[model samples]
Target: MTVFRVGCPHCGGRAHLESGEVRLARTRSRTFYAFTCPDCGEPVRKPAGERIVELLTGNGVAEIGLAPR
Candidate 1:
């Protein structure tokens, strides 16, 4: 399984999650990713830049909302 390192602002903790645990969403103006923090059990969302979008999409992370171009 592919593990991704994610940070939780709530508890200041970092955890690794599988690709299925991460969600990608793209809008007309921006892209974003979201995941539940394993360590703190908090739902977190962050903006995904060009490199981030590429990284997640290339790693087989499921995307919702808008389709990638």
Candidate 2:
């Protein structure tokens, strides 16, 4: 399991990602993800796994670890 953090491009909001949820969804893909904006109270859907990975790694999608603190 891995954890990912996405800083919203809009409103500079923050969201966290856990294992099994891809950062983004592909066309026709049924995978679901949710993120809420802290500043705007907006809900954002992940678009694609790559997009989310880019946000975290900045280079490419890499494996993440999500162990309870």
Candidate 3:
């Protein structure tokens, strides 16, 4: 399983999440990712640039939402 190490702003800790646990949203000009913090169960969302989107998608993280016009 692919695991991503992400920082949890809620608990101020780092969490390891599987690819399935993450949601990626992308558009022509922007990209972002969201996941629930395993440590605190809080929903976390953050901006993702091109490189971040590439790395996450390359590792099998699922893409979500519609691309903007």
Candidate 4:
């Protein structure tokens, strides 16, 4: 299984998450990848680029699309 590494700003720790632990959100202007920080349980959101979107989706990360206003 592939592990995705994300940093937690609240706890100052990096978490290694699996596909189930990560989510992809698409908005009108930008895309974001969200996950929970394993160390502090804080929610983490990061802007995702095209390459990232492709990688996450290809890796089995859940994706959600937000309605555009």
Q: Which window of ten consecutive residues has the lowest lDDT sum in model 3? A: 23-32
lDDT for residue 15 in candidate 1, whole number 0-100? 90
Q: How many residue pairs in model 3 have overlapping backbones?
A: 0
Report the Cα lDDT for candidate 4: 0.90
Please give the distance, in angstroms, between residue 36's alpha carbon in candidate 3 and its true position after superposition: 0.1
Please give, for residues 1-69, the per-residue lDDT of candidate 3 as tens digits.
Answer: 899999998899897889999999877777889999888889998999878988999999999977485
Candidate 2 to truth, TM: 0.36
Off by over 4 Å in 2: 15-32, 49-69
For model 1, the stretches where C-alpha displacement exceeds 4 angstroms are 66-69
Regarding lDDT, does 2 or 3 come out ahead?
3
Q: What pairs collide in candidate 2?
A: 2-64, 2-65, 2-66, 24-48, 24-49, 25-47, 25-48
Better of 1 and 3 by TM-score: 1
TM-score of each model, in listed order? 0.87, 0.36, 0.85, 0.89
Query: What is the C-alpha lDDT profile of model 1 across 1-69, one tens digit per residue?
Result: 688998898999989889999999987877889999888788999999989989999998999876546
Worst 10 residues of 4 by lDDT: 60-69
**Two-way TM-score contest, 1 vs 4, winner:** 4
Rank order (by TM-score, best first)? 4, 1, 3, 2
Higher-ranked by TM-score: 2 or 4? 4
Q: Mind giving the per-residue lDDT tens digits that candidate 2 earns over 1-69?
A: 566666666677766655444333333434334555556777776544655545544533344333333
Model 1 lDDT at residue 38:
84
